[model samples]
Target chain A: MICMNELQLTVDIYALVITTLTLVNAGAVYMIFYEMFKRFYGAKLKFETPVKNMMTLCGMEVTDEVKHLVPVSEIMVFTFRKAFKHITESLTSEFESKVLRDWFFYALIILTALIVLSLIMGWY
Target chain B: MTDLNLGIVLVSEVLIYPGLMFLVATIIFTQWLWRKIAARLGFRRGPMKTGPAGVLQPMADLLKLLSKEEVRTALSSKRLPALIAPLGIGALSTVLLTTPLAPLPIWSPFDSLVVLYLILWATVSIVILALSTPNPYTNIGVGRYLAFIVAAEPPFFISVLVPIILASRYYSDVNYSIYKTSLYSSSLWGLNPLTATLMLLSAFSGFISMMAVMNIKPFDAAEAETEIYWGIFTEFGGPRLALGMFISFAERVVLPLIYTFLFLGGSSPFTFTDNYLASLITTLIKFFVIFSILAIIDTLMPRFRPDQAVRFLIKYALTTAVIALIASITLTFIY
Candidate 1:
């Protein structure tokens, strides 16, 4: 680790880059995911719970109308089958919204790198 | 100040008097004041336990929230960037250093630009938190929140910037700094017809923008419980809920405090150089006075649709801001 204080401007620039990226990407994904979420969970399933809320909605009778919904009575089976179906049914899995989970991990990688850089710079 | 002393003063400014501690204290105090005002208006008693006149109620609630489980979702919304929520708070607290209320206020050429950006940091931080989780209600709420911000933030920025321009032109101040502009803003009013009119229009424009940005009533469509399920906070619970609430309460503090400095007069009648304590006290009084006015308006006004609020903000707040800006720039050249 270099003990140089000459890189202070670089550090500020690094901080700005990370903050701006985080804000822009978060906002973009939010709007994008919302549009997709609304379209996928369109009019018929508007009131229906998605598979992501499997555990939260455990034991509740599953909607028979929705395609690929493996209607089951057992709580454990319902949770497991729904979780499996959730993964197979979509490209993004949509833990909340499509890409949000991916975005979360993406942001973390950047943040972790920045944190390490700050640590090396002694920017405590 | 020498380098070591300057370091000490800057550190203290960020951590103590005008920074983190001051921010938390303001949150608790302002929360109490707002609740009490609302309760009074509704003919009911606000929190009167936990501390004298329920002053510590907010703290108590915060502690309770802290004790609860930070609910983990399937996604890493709250977990991955846990720092974002606190970072919002940090960004806001940092802005206090730019005001005359600080014992040793900081100044830099065009620091008002930095202050403007810093306040938005708090705002976007909240947006990040809101976007982390997914719910149908949350999405609509966040959409409304974004709409309101898009409509309100520019005018708010311009309104705050008007004072800086007026001060720079009128006072021939050393630099483009919020502190200098604020100190000069108190006297800018009634100096000349142009200045007086500019201040009046700018003040009204700023007040509306502030209310809308803070999600105070009439413009609170984003955060109103009746309108959407907790708006941006639909997914939060436990400690995350506390952090979300802290962001809201802290916002209510910073926006008004800055408005007090830039528009209403930082600490009139008591110059910070002559008496720091008196000036600080005066600043806080004026700060609450503005907050109380907003709260009273919130109590009386009905919630406006997000589209309606956007239209009003564009039509009224932005128009007035432009008029104020032109007036101030013209006045700057005249005198």
Candidate 2:
């Protein structure tokens, strides 16, 4: 007969296995559905529709044909890339001007410093 | 006392102190407080006509609802799940007693894991109950709820592990169950910086995830009243609706209580004293603090779209939880 410790270990192992399997299953299902939706509806629902419509509404010029080539499934990725580029451009300009452009930077710096200090002092 | 007498005592304990009676009382108080505070925040007088600034408002509401006849739609299917859905509140209350809310918890080696599963069970019962009605609105709500669950559950599970890992490290014993771990890890946050940071991050992420799990504002896509007409409860009316409301209220109280026990050092504020009453009071205070935080968040934020809610949980909260888990595991090895 297994002791309490052994039983507990077994339970932990079982839990780990179950959690891993569930995550894997969820990921697989999501990917499958995403691919299916993209393959079936990507071309029809491209720019000049929801995304491009929103962009136009926000006064952004949507004259780029290259954006239309990206599938709806990759819209988030494309948006993230554009956002990152914009942020980098802004940061570079701000740093060149030698002025702290955003209050967020100060907050980040202070938070990071506090965390580092806490780490060094062992005062988590 | 003989075995039968002992059995009766155990049953009474489960049904009385820290059990159904206590839980029902707490739920009533918490529901009233939630409404009163929300009203105050919104600059309105809430439940003033009820007993003593709405302290007994929840009780009065419950009585009114129970006095009404139960109603169901003609298209609804499977009366069993709908009838049984409210019983989830009782199941959760029973599970809460297993937590170390008092000086002496109903201790068991694997009780913490049981709590986790029971929570899942409660949520599943809710989904089942929602689906039982077969209404289009409820179907949409269930779809959103399932999506939130898929995104939230992994990080939540991982965050729960952070404390267990830290506690095992603290005790230098790998075999301690979550209940034992939580009991010993009352002072876990005051430990070294790494663990403290990890615990803090985990708790924060866990709290965010709990907001979604408990269907609070911002993450409350499944119950967006404007969009889906109260979502899952669109078809439920009268007594059954009352039960669903009571269940949600209990969930509001119990989820925070669990978190308080797991992370905020349950009863630790009064650990210097040997009095059980002191421990219980301190624990309740901690619970209220957590509850108030949730309340403020609910008041301030707007509801997220289902996709955005899922994305936030997966992209941000899950990442934090994973980082905390890895850090805790690494620290365990180092210590």
Candidate 3:
């Protein structure tokens, strides 16, 4: 049977670790988005020429998305779209490969377990 | 002893002096060795003329850095957290004081694990602050650094835990103080060949990965000069550069020392009649041995592309970490 003090210390350690991991992961996510934006700023675009006779701006690909997304007039709208894009890329591993991303997630899961265990078992 | 009285004395004498001195020594040693290694690799004598194989080279470099003019671009974000960057690094290094530098009972705090995580995040905070400096190269460097940190940290933490778990199961006392727990020669796997190999491999692999995380060599993409002009350090000059350099060196030596203490047999390698001096000498020797190996590798190997390097660690190095953990888990039942 554990004393209240030891149990409280264990709980406090868990809280500390989880909070730290969450913050670090948040930072990682922010960096991923930041890198995407930096790359987008420098990325080249390709366009197909449109005929004057065509009523539509066919093949022009002149949607707002074609332009830089960071400088949108409505900040919230831009953020939503950017966040969505980032999630899609991260999930599908479109930026890299799905397999590697899954493995990374597995490693994260194991790491989280280790941290929690350390806190509970008090492996200081 | 009263907790208040203990904390005060410990924070000042135990924390401040030795921690600061170690940081200074690490900076000096790393700089001198880096120059010597670079010169040797390039087939030139580096600083041999300065003082006995240029042992005083670090002192000269320190003076040079101090004498250089501190420059900040006029158009930069003047309201930015300039001091935060270096202060954060120094603070992060101070967290190492919580680690049992010697096997002394007084040194180990109750929340040592928490302190370790705090140290890492503090270092990352410094990285974020450095990135926020509005320098384009710095931003790119920070991006790469964040990715590496994300990729490397999970494996690093998990790997460290294997030894901890293996060591823990052998504890004779369920009421053992966390600091008194031993991993050395306890045979967490109890002489099982396969499990022993797995544990050793995990410990070794995790250690090398940590070295890479500390940016020792071939895995050093964040500040690869050819890829980006000194990487995140492109715009820093004068005292700020000096601080960054010091932080890097401190990180290099200290992280390796922690790894050595935790995983590489700790004080068992030396039977110190004079306990304090013996432990200190043991630590310094172990530190240099690890640093020299890294320096040689840095000279011998070519830097990897960021993407390729990330994949390689995830695929190969991390597998070894998993293997170690699994072996420990397996041995838990058998033993």
Candidate 4:
């Protein structure tokens, strides 16, 4: 019969977790990012007229006045100002803020634990 | 055990009883129970025609969905990960083998980690299926699901872990096994004051997370039919739709079954180690209670906007879990 010791099982469990989360989160992250790109950068990426959705649902910046101000999709406004602006707006969105807050909260806990462990392991 | 014995165990435990087959049976029955409860609460009749008071309605619905014509939208391509939905079912089934429901349960030290991962995978599988269709409504649904996942999953992971952690401290052999934890979960309440409080907080957080993860009312913005046209399944039809729906239907049974065991002390009045059938009956009774409560809550509550749902889950469920986990870690030091 196949069996594992407690230590081996612990290692196996962590391996299973790390691998699964890496895969699942990578796909979810990509899907969300791709959807955001499609929604926000649709007109600019294709050099087509942007759908400037002025009515913001959930207070998101669906309308891009920057597209109207730019003479061409290749202009510097496209390179620096619009890209950063969109990033800032997206980051500042309520959804993004909540998500970021959760990430920060989790990261703080994990990092604190890891640092304590490191000190214990390396203390002379 | 001999090879023949091992093979029998695998087939009986994993395939026949309390595994894939049992999960299917549970889903069929619970779907009926859910509808019946919801209907009664709403002052309506549920599925009285399917099979002896609508016992087979979920099955009939599945077959009907399977028989429908496959509608492929212009957006749906061969590139989408349609196969993932079944894999979600596979994950759910695999996790069940580690619970007390299985006669010869499959287990290992710290295997609850894998169980938690599988539960998360089931959610991911649905999201990946939704992402296959790149429509505006699908995108919005996917966004809402993402927000909900981010808000709900960690709290659940941490909350569930509190039980396992506390249980491990109580028993040398517990080793974070789901079955082991469930066997002694009720004892956790009587440990001391800190653990009792932690259990209360974690259980509350876990229930809220479970509601969000199941995508029921007040947290189902991802599937808000009026707004997003069935949300993530906007472009899904035919076999794909059936499989997507099957994954969801299976989850309604699977997650609650796990919760009943982990939190409600699986077969508490009767341990499986003593009498398997008695324990199984007790487990079923507990599962029904939890299933009914959740279903009634679902029927009574209205949908929350995606943003509102995420914010509430984070503020309440997530905060409660964090406190619970920190307290659990501290309690370990005390003991």
Candidate 5:
């Protein structure tokens, strides 16, 4: 027969474990969502090009005269949209064709189901 | 001794043994060891002329850099951040003092959390220093660094939590809060097979992420010499460069020490004996083993492209971390 303290300890451990797993899952899902959204919608948000900056700093005399010919911001937005479309198309095709990607998604699903079952059953 | 004397002793303990001086010395020695080993592997004699098998090479290099004149470029701005960036290395070394590698673990509530934040702080300081220079190469390097952080941080953070959760399972005494319990405790190890396997996987994932954090090879895209001309560090030279090198070396030493503590049972292997020295020795041995593995990997692997590195971290590392989290939760019920 288990003592009351022993049972309580088990329950506490169980609670902590469940809470932690839930938090991790939620966080991972959020990151996946954020990454996808950013890839598609976050245009005109590119990091500055380092090599060009260094050249200009060194007085090599470089200029984006093309920007004066056409609006630089509009050109950037257009290129970013094209890049985003390309990435999305490639990723979609890869997801459809790749066995390993399918397996990974399946694994994630199984894992999620197990966690939910464990929570509902009060495994402690 | 009075309280004041006691305070002085504690301060000296942090500054001297198993602390700043000790960490700096060990980092220098380890950097030398890494170079020698890499050189031999590549069938070349490395640093043979410097103090007995190039043991003093790092020291000599440091001295040379310190003696050189400081150079500042016209494009560089915000002198303060650039000057203070080297101090971030010192801050990283301080984290070691609080770890189990010390003769005495600097007991604190949430010391683990503190260590995590300190690592981030040190990393961010470097990026800030890079941006202050207004160099294009540095900017690109900083961008790569940010992307690496985003991919690495999640898995690393999640994997670290596994041990914390495992440690919390054994928390019984009222005085021993979840944060107070040492993650290095042996109770966290030698579990049932399933949980043990999961824990090992988590450790492996954490180790990979940490390699990126430490800027080891393959993951060192931010500093790819061939492409970006030394990336974020292109502008730094002389004493500042020495400081940067020392910081990297210190990270190489301290990170493995933390890895041993969190995942390799720390000093627990020697816990059967009452002697603290034995425990410390065992812990040091474990640290060396992990360091050697990292060094070997660094020697053998080629650098990854920044995008590929981020993809690997997210796809592989995150999978392992999720598995570990699920397994840890399952094990909690069984135990």
Candidate 6:
């Protein structure tokens, strides 16, 4: 069995470490989904021709009035393409990388190994 | 008639038939307390016809539950955990055997550490077993159970450590014999005021959090009534449900005893005079104090949504525990 003092210290460390890991897990999930949602919606909002027309006619300076009145449907096809492109770009760029996935899997493996080791040591 | 002598008598009484009776009485009392408190909160007198102060109401309820037709849902999970969950909870009530009531030891070969471990292990096992049942409603209830456990267990473990650490540090002799000694006379960290205060605070927070985590009202997301047909208990009925409720009452009984023993100076209070009787009285009083507060809370407060409840505990319960630990450590050096 682990020494009592050592076990106490280990438990304290374990609690802190797990709390950190859970927070990180929550953060990563939020960030990934947030980015996907933002990009998808951003592209959709830019789809209207009137929006593009206003952007072009006003060139550098469109009235806020015309901007609000312009229906996004006018830009549907272009915006749809843009949205699809953004979705594809985000998914491929964010998750398709070998290194990032490897890092995640490696971290998971390391954490599992550490927890198993601690439980084993503490259990006996 | 001295306090120390009375304590010895109380411990001895616990070793005999009286202790078992005490356990039964606690279950009955807790049920009664629940009803009365629940009624009072709603501006009504609860179960008055059952006897004076509705004392016999528990017996009536017990009989009804015992005779009620068993209703097993057609789609219920057919597994050992489902069968065993209530039994496990019942067994957990037995683990309460280690708790001292009225400053009296309930049994021999008492290992404080083991008792604490047993309580946690039993409760966790019961919870896991209960959550394994597979109705979609039960599934959500179990999710809430998991969330509550996650929120509550850390604070509990931390709180349990306070007294153990104090005992280890203050008393020159190790071996956990400090349970026999009076808190007032004990050298708890050599009489540091901060340590004393933090120890008290930690014990209180631990008590509250344990009550909440154990599915006592306001904190009872896993067993919310209107939301999920008694939440995780959606499927339990008849004798099985009775057993589960009994186990819950037993848990309620044991929690206060554990808290009292660890923090309020175990078994010494009733040992002051007429040892057995005094100890019994003290135990009943302490248990009632703890039970009544919880019952009142259950009646008065609205049940919280799981997420909101978790956040509330994080702020109130966890913060107090952190503060207590800090205070204890600071006092260990300065005083």
- The lDDT per prediction is 0.68, 0.64, 0.54, 0.70, 0.61, 0.53
- lDDT by residue (tens digit), candidate 2, B96-213: 5456553223444444575678678668767777766655556667777777776777788778788888887777543446656656667788776667777877887788888888
Model 4 local distance difference test score: 0.70
How good is model 4 by TM-score? 0.74
Worst 10 residues of 3 chain B by lDDT: B174-183
Q: lDDT ranking from best to worst? A: 4, 1, 2, 5, 3, 6
Q: Please, what are the lDDT tens digits per residue for candidate 2 over residues A1-124?
A: 2232122235555354334323332233223322333344432342234332121111335332223222322433443354345546656876644326455346435544555565456553
User: Which candidate's lDDT is highest?
Assistant: 4
Q: Which segments of model 2 are wrong by more than 4 Å? A: A1-124, B102-104, B172-174
Interface Cα RMSD, each model? 20.9, 16.4, 16.7, 14.3, 16.6, 24.9
Docking quality level of the chain pair in candidate 2? incorrect
TM-score of chain A of each: 0.28, 0.39, 0.28, 0.27, 0.28, 0.26
Note the B-chain TM-score for every model. Answer: 0.96, 0.93, 0.84, 0.96, 0.91, 0.80
Q: Which lDDT tens digits does candidate 1 get at residues A1-124?
A: 1111111113344345334433443343233322233334321242333543321222455432223222212322333344345445544555545434565346434544543453355332
Cα lDDT tens digits, model 4, B1-335, are: 68577556655554456666677778888888888998999899999998898899988876655555444444455545545775677677667767877666666677887789888888989988876655566666777787788778999899899899888877887987876898899888777655676687788889999999999888888788888678778767655676787778778888888888878888888988778889888988988898888998999998886656766777678877887787667655654
Q: Native-vs-model 1 lDDT? A: 0.68
Give candidates' CA RMSD values in order: 17.6, 12.9, 13.2, 11.7, 12.4, 21.3
| Model 1 bad stretches (over 4 Å) | A1-124, B76-78, B333-335
User: Which segments of model 6 are wrong by more than 4 Å?
Assistant: A1-124, B1-21, B77-90, B101-110, B173-190, B266-274, B326-335
Cα miss at A12, model 2 (Å)? 13
Which 10 residues in a row give candidate 5 chain B its minimum summed lDDT? Answer: B174-183
Q: Write the per-residue lDDT of candidate 1 for residues B1-335, one digit (tens) a residue.
A: 36576556656666677777778788888888888999999999999998998999988987666555445345435353355776677777777766777766655657677778878987887888876765444556666777778778988998998888878875664355776788788887866555666677788889999998899989887777865658778667656677778778889999999999888888888888788789888988998889899889998899986666776787678777876776556555552
Model 4 chain B lowest lDDT segment of ten: B67-76
